[model samples]
Target: MAMRRFGVAIVLSVILMAAFAAGLSAAKRGISVGEWLSVPFSDASFAKRWGYGETNGARNVISADRAQQRNGKPTLRLDTNSGFDCWVYFPNTKDWDIDLSKAKVMRGYLRSENKNGWGGDPWIIFVDMAGRKARFDGLKQRLYDAINDWTEIVVPVGADLDAKCAEYGWKAQISPGFDWKHISCVQIHQDTDGSGYTMWYSGFEFIDYAGRTIKWWLSSINKPDLSVTYAEQVPQYKRYIASEPDPNYNIPELVGSAATEKHWPNEGEQIKYLVHIKNAGFARSKPTDFVCMIDGKVVKKASLPALAPHQVTTIVVNWKWKQGPYQFAASVDTKNKLDEITKKNNTLRFKTDAYVLVAVCEKSIVAPIEQVNNWYGSFCFEDWMRGATIDQLNSLFKRCKYDFAPNGAEVSVRLGKIFLVDELPDDGAKIGEIDKGLGLYIFDGVWHYPLRAIHEWCDLANDFDWALNHELSHQLGIIDDYQYDMGPDSNLVNHKAYDRGPGGIMGGGQVGDNVYPAYADVDIAGFNLTKGHRRGFFGEYLYCIPYKNTLVLSIDGRPLADKDIEIYQKSMYTGKIEAPPVFTGKTDAEGRFPLANRPVPKDFTTATGCTLHANPWGYPDVVGRNGLFLIRTQVDGKWYYGFIDIGRFVCEYARGHKDNAVYSVKLMPE
Candidate 1:
C-alpha cells in the first residue's frame, strides 16, 4: 500500500503541479500564502480526533486516514456531504493572533473535486482584536457559484459589502474602521454547505502592497503562492473592489489659525483671530461647531454651515484681553459627535499675543459714522465679533491659513480705530462746489476721511468700497499702481504683469462692487464707468506708500507765510479746463506746505466742452486736462494766485528737486 501510494503521489504531483511554475512567476512579482495552509493536517489520528471522520454516506465521509498526497506533501482535505458544516478553531480564538494592521488584503485558495456543494456558503474569515470584532464576509454566495477547480479568494479590508449574517452571524452594517492591529483571533469556517465533495485549501495570508512576500513555509521552493495576484485579477471581486473606503465619509478638520499680526505696541487694542474650518471628506460636511479658547477659557463660538467636500471657511473673530501672552486654541466639533477619519486634526492650538482694540467712531455730514464702524460688510467683517460688535475696519487684519487671493499680500496693520467723519475731520466748512472725489490723509497718527464727499465721488469711485481697501493698503505701505510721468526726466513705470493679471484695489482708484486682486484674463467691464477693475499697476512699492510731496512757497522772491493753499483738479469729463480745489493746507512759517492726492481725478473744461480726465493736467505743455492751475492764497493780505502747470511742475520736481527744497515755487500775481 505504501509503494502504491508513493507511486500515485508522484503521478498526482505531476498533474497538480503543472501550473506550479506559473504561480511562482506571479509570486515573484509580489504575493503571499497563509501559513495555515501548509500547517500539517495529515495525521490520521489528528483528523479523526477533530471529528473530520464524520460521514452520512460512502461518498460524503471525511478523510479517515489521510487522502492521497501530491508529491508526498500533506494538506488539509475534506470529503464533505451536500449538507456539511464545520470549522477548525485554534486554542480558543487567540491562537490566530497576528498583526495585520498594514495588510491590504486577505487571500487564499480553494479547490474541490465536486464544485457543486463545496462553496454553497461563503468561507468566512472572522477576526477579532482587543474587544472589537468584525467579519470579512459577503462573497459566500458568489463563492458558492464559482465554477473553476482552483479558485483564488481575496477579501479586502475596510471596503467590502457586508452580508446579512444569520442569528449568530455578523450584522449587515458599515464597519466603523478596520482595526488591523493586533488581530488576536480568526476563524476559518463554513456554514450550511451542500453536496458530496472533496476539497483542499492551502497557502493563505494577509498581504499589503503589490510586490509583497508571503511568509508561507512552502515559499522556500519555487511553488507559486498566487493568492495576492489572483485577488486582483479575479472578476468576481471586480464589483466589490474599492480603494479601501472609509465608512466615515468626512472629517471636519480645523487647521491652525492665527492673528494677522502677532505683535502690537499697545495694550488696549483688539487682537484679531482667524479660525480655519475645512471639510476633509469625500462628501459634504454637516454643520459643525467652531469654538475658541483663550488660556483654556471659552472666549468665542460660532456655528459653521455645511461645507462642500474640501471646502474651506475662515471665521474672523476680534477679541480683547489684557495685553500679555495668551494661548489661543480653537477646535471644531469638539463634542466628538461626528464620525471622522481622525480626531487629532479637529483641534488646533495657537499661541498668540492677545490685546484689546481701542477704536472710536466719529461721523459727520449727517452720516451715521457709528453705523459705518459697527455694521459689518462683505469679506472679513460680515457680522458682530467676539462678545460685542467691533469696528468694521478692525476685522481686515485677521489672517487665515489660506489666502483668498493667491497674490493678495497678507498685510498686518496696527490696531486702530476706523474714523468715520463727514468731511475729513474738521474741514472747518465746505467751500465752493465740492467734487465727489475724496482723499485720505494721516495726521497725528489718525486717519481722517471726508463723509459727505463720498456721495460726490459716488460717480467717480471705481468701486464703492475699493477706496477703503486701497487706502488701507496704502497705510500698510503699498504704493500706487497708476503709471504717471513724475516729470520730463523721470517717467515712473511699474511691472506690467501685476498691472493686468488680477484687478486689484491698489491698481486704480476704482470703487464699487469688486473682488480682491485675483488676476484673470478679461476685459474690464462695469455697469457704471467706475464699477469694474481699473487699469493700473500692482506692487509698484510693496513696503513704501506714496509720500506727501512738499511745496516751498515764496511771493516775489520773499517767503509767503501762513498762506492758505489748496490743490485743485481742473480736468473735467467734458475735455474742458475748470478750477476746483480738492485738498486744502496752509504754508508754515518756513513758507512750505505738505501736499498729497496730487493729480487728483477731477473734471476739467476743454475746447471739446467738459471731458473728465483721470489726472489734472494744469498745463498746455503737458497736454493734460487743465491749461493751467491756480494756487490760491493770501499774500500781503491780498488774494494772489500762482499759475501752475501740473505735469511740468511734477517733471521739474523729479529732475531738479532732490533735497528738502522739493518744489521751490515763487507765487506770482495772477
Candidate 2:
C-alpha cells in the first residue's frame, strides 16, 4: 500500500510541473520578472516585537533583529528617543529599471510604526540616483488620517510635474524621459510636542492610468477615433468654438429714451448717428473681423483687440437709406454655431428708422437773446448751448425740434435777492439759498468791493457779457466753480488771482484773465456742451414753471400762494415770437396765476419794451413793485406772465432798498 501511494504522489507532482511550463510558454513577451524590492511589513508584526533607537544623523534607527528569525520584516527598529525618527533605504541592488517613457502613473503605499512615529506624520521619499533629489514636500502631512491605513498615492508625469519638480530645487537638466531609479531614504517625524506615534505599510504598484480616454472607451463602444491630426487652417475654415458668447454682441432693446415713429430722424440726416455698444454678455468679444456697413456700403470697421463681456463701447455709425423708409440694422458675428446649435453664434441686429430731414451746413447767426433765455431755461436744454455757435443751436433745434419744443413750455427760473448794502452773513439760510441755485451772492462791504463795483457799474455791458454769461450759463445747465466766493469784491481778476494758478471761470478774471475766457474754461464749457447736462443736475429740477392757463404761483412744479409768484413783463409788443416774451410769475398753492390782464400803458412802453412786476411775500427784499410796467402774452393758447425790464428793475431796486430792510412789490395792470 505504501509503494502504491508513493507512485501516485510522483505522478501528481509531474502533472503540476507540466501545466506550469505550458502557461509560461503562452505568456506575451516582455521584460521578465526579476528580484524586486520587498515590502518591509505585512500586518502588525513590526510594532509588536521590535525594539527601536536613533542615530546622531537625525535618522530613526531600529535595533537590529536576528536575520534568520525576522524573515523579510524590517530588521532595524527606528529610535523614539527624541520623539519619532526613522529611515529606510531602497537599495539599488536589483535590475529594476522603470521605463518612464511608457509609464503613465507612478504610485506607492507607505506607513510607519514606532508608537511615536505612528501618531506623528511621516513622508516617504523617492530619489533618483541618475539625477538630483526631488522633494514632494507636505504630501504626507496633508493625508493625516490617511497615513495609518495602507494608502495608495499616485503622481502623473506631465508638464505640471516637470514644472513642479523644477520649481523645488530639482536639477532642471532632467527631461520628462528621466526615470525614478531609486528611493535613497524614507523617514518619520513628530511635531514639536513630542507625541509618540507608530504605523505599518505594505502594497506598492505602478498603474497604467488612462483618464478621460479610458472613460470614453468604457462609456461608448462606437466612439470616434482620435488618432487623426490636422495642421494649418484659416480661422474661417476652422471650427471656431468659443467657451462663451461675445460680450459686445447685444440683443435689440430700447436704451436711453424710447424711440417714436414720428420723432425718428430723416434718412439722410440719420446717416451719422451715435449709439453706444455695450457688452451685455458674459464673455469677451474679439472684434478682429467686425465691419460696419450703411445701406450695404462699408462705412466703418473695428478691430477691438478684445471687448470684455459687459464692457461698453460707443460707436457712431452712418444710417443710410436706399430709397426707402426701411430701418437700418447693426449686426455682429458670434462665431460659435458649429459646435452647438445656439442663437449666440448668429449675427445680432438692432434696427431703427432713418431720420426725416436732410442735414445741411448753415452759416452761424447769433441766437436771439430771447431764444437764448428759453433754450437755457428748458428742462431738456443741454449745456452745449452755453457755448454753442448759433449754427449748432439751430442744427440741434432742427434735429430735435419736436422734443425740444414741448420741453420749452415748461421752462422757469428760481431767483434770490443779493443785497449790496451790508456784509453778508454766512448763516445756514444764506448757505441754503446759495446751495439751491449754486450761484454767486455779492455784497458791497468786502475790501475789494470798490474795484468790483466799478466793473459792475461802469462795465454794465461787459458785466452783462461776463455776469449774465456766467450766471445764465448756470441756469443753462452749466456747472459752477463752487470754489469761488460770491462776495462783492470778487471780479474776474480776483477769481483768477485768488487761486494763484491758472484762473478758471470760478477763479474770477485775474489768472488766465484774457477778457474773453481761459482755454481751460472754454474747454470745460465745450465739454459741458458735448456731454449734455451737467453731472450735478441729474436729480435736481432743470426748471420750474407756473401751471399753464392757471392764474396761480408755482415753485419747482408745485403750486404756491399768489404771494410766492413774482412777475416781470417787458414793455415792447414787437410781435417777434422768437424772442423770450418778457414774462415771469411766482406760484401759489392753486398754481401760478396771471398777475395782470391789461395791456401796458403807452407812457411805460420805452424804445425797447414795457415792464411788469410781481413779488413773493416774506421775501420783502425781492420787491416786485419797483418795475415800471406789466405786460401780457399768450403761449400755447394760454395767457402767460412776464416782467418787461428785469435789468432796469434790478438796478433801480438795488439803489433804493435799505440795508437789512426787506421790501415787497406787486404788478397791477391798468
Candidate 2: worst-modelled 10 consecutive residues by lDDT: 1-10
Candidate 1 per-residue C-alpha lDDT over 1-670 given as tens digits, one digit per residue, 9 for 90 to 100: 1000000101111112236744753454233221222232222322321222111212223332345443354444555453444443222213234556555565655555554444344545444444355654453454454334455666654333332143222333323554655454444555444455655554345566573632322211111100000000001000000121223211111122311212233455565555555554334456778777877788888887777644567776566644444566677777755544223346544334211222222344222221111111100111112101212222332311121222122222222223333334343344111212221111101233445443222111111244544454443323343321122122111101111113334453222233343211111111011111111111211101113356777887877787688654434234322345655778898888875533322333221111222322321222223323446676557765554433233333223332222567776554
Give the best candidate by lDDT. Answer: 1
RMSD of every candidate to native, in Å, equals 30.5, 33.4
| Regions more than 4 Å wrong, model 2 | 1-85, 92-95, 108-122, 139-143, 146-152, 155-196, 210-670
The reply for model 1, stretches above 4 Å from the true place, is: 1-73, 81-85, 89-93, 114-121, 140-148, 158-178, 191-196, 214-670
In model 2, the number of clashes is 78
Task: Provide TM-scores for the models.
Answer: 0.22, 0.20
Candidate 1 differs from the real structure by a C-alpha RMSD in angstroms, to one decimal, of 30.5
Best by TM-score: 1
